[model samples]
Target: MTQNGFEKTGDDALDAAFAAARAARPQPSAALMAAIRADAAREAAAAPRAARPRPAPARASTRPWAGFWRALGGWPSAGTLAASLVLGIAIGGQQAVPLAGLDILAPASGPLDEAAVADLLPGIDAFLTEG
Candidate 1:
């Protein structure tokens, strides 16, 4: 339809129905607009307000810790840094697993056996079998 990308139906029956409805719709009278404008004028004249000064713009912080805190960028980035540090400590200390079957899948690539996976994640078997 129109600019929304759907096809516009050009049926004569629907067009006649729409034309009838458009002719039947109620229209605003000139008296209503006159009354609305009077009410708006009355309210504006009744309310008296004091003149307020504009606030001064904020300046950047110059403290030593301010640069550090700004670099951290608040709690979301801080939490991300803490999570990355914990994961780094966990993965960094893990022992490397030795692969044996290097010719099964590819001539150079090693086999991904159970022992190899166990060496990578010790309790993976227990976790997988816990139904």
Candidate 2:
């Protein structure tokens, strides 16, 4: 089942397209590769190093909105805060509107009946109708 018995050879380790099978030849030491590595190391070591130019310092922003950015770090914009405050005031007005003259809901409406609520509710018609 092996194609040229290369499968048992494991991976593509010996699958050099241009080279003949090892059974027909002998491997040699990689003296050529060693010479190439040494040459590259010598060239890299002997090369003159150039100093990198320092970058200009970051300019301090004078924009008025910069303070707002610094204040919240990354909070919502001023218009958003104003809009939220408006929405809060609008919703708060609903609850406040239900109250009479900004006074307490209890005293302004009068005291609760001391009688049990069940009795009052069940005989509500009679209690309210009767003097």
Q: Compare the candidates by TM-score and give the number of the best one.
A: 1
lDDT of 2 at 63: 96
Candidate 2 segments whose C-alpha is farther than 4 A from its true place: 1-51, 54-71, 74-76, 94-110, 116-131
lDDT of 2 by residue, 1-131 (tens): 25564445444655563235555675555997788889999988877655435676888789998877878645556668788999999987874445455333254465765454444468776776788
Model 2 lDDT at residue 64: 95
| Residue 130 of model 2, lDDT score | 83
Which candidate leads the pack in lDDT?
Answer: 1
Residue 120 error for model 2, in Å?
Answer: 8.2
lDDT of 1: 0.75
What are the models' TM-scores?
0.31, 0.27
Report how far residue 34 has shifted in candidate 1, in Å: 32
